[model samples]
Target: MKTIHLIVHGHIQGVGFRYFAQTTAQSKKVTGWVKNQEDGTVEAVAQGTENQLQSFVHTLRSGNRYARVEEIKVSEADQDQTYAGFKIIR
Candidate 1:
């Protein structure tokens, strides 16, 4: 399994990005959480198989129609962090 933490910048907040991420993650069978940051960025942590994570990353890059993602900072994450499913954190 693989896990990734991503900080997405640009027109990401208030653009249904969290829901988009949740749906995309579920489709890829990944478990994660998406949350909005005070700095006007979107943060997420996804865990799944390497293939699943790769596909999820692609979806993140593409984003939803309302989101104009300018940058996504990705880093290795602990696979031990678990979630029942993808969720939008407040």
Candidate 2:
């Protein structure tokens, strides 16, 4: 199991990116949370198998029909997050 942290940049806010990410994560069986950052970025943490994590990140980058993702910053995250399911944080 691994945790992937992502800071998605570009016009991601107010575009249902968080909800899109949550749905995508759930479909991929990735557990974690996604939220809007103050810096106009979307921050997400996903934990799962390598394949699942990869797919989750892909979905985030591709975004939904409303989003226009410019770039995505990826990094490792602490494995102790232990989220029960994917969610959108306030």
Candidate 3:
């Protein structure tokens, strides 16, 4: 198992980025949360097998047409065993 945090930049606000990310995470059996940042970036955490995490990142890199994710910053994260499922944080 692995955990990763990602800050996605460029045209990531509105346009259902959080919803898309949540859907992708659920389908991939990844657990964590997604939310908007104050600086117009999208942030997310994914916890699961390394393969699933990689796939999730790939999907984020090439988001839905409505979104244009120009860059993503990823880092290791502490385990969050309490997270039950993927969601859009308030």
Provide the clashing-pair count of each candidate structure: 0, 0, 0
Cα lDDT tens digits, model 2, 10-69, are 998998889999999889999999999999999988899999988888777788999999
Q: Would you list the rank order by lDDT, best first? A: 3, 1, 2
Q: Highest TM-score, which number? A: 2
1-90: candidate 1 lDDT, tens digit per residue = 788999999898888999999999999999989999999999999999889988998888998999998889999987776777888899
lDDT of each: 0.90, 0.90, 0.91
Instruction: Report the C-alpha lDDT of model 3 over 1-90, residue by residue, as the tens digit.
Output: 899999999997989899999999999999999999999999888899999999999998998889998999999999946578998998
RMSD of each: 1.0, 0.8, 1.0
Cα displacement (angstroms), candidate 3, residue 41, comes to 0.4
> Looking at candidate 2, what is the lDDT of residue 71?
96
Model 2 is weakest, by summed lDDT over 10 consecutive residues, at: 54-63
Sequence-dependent TM-score of model 3: 0.95
Better of 1 and 3 by TM-score: 3
The CA root-mean-square deviation of candidate 2, after full C-alpha superposition on the true structure, stands at: 0.8
67, model 1: CA deviation in Å?
A: 0.5
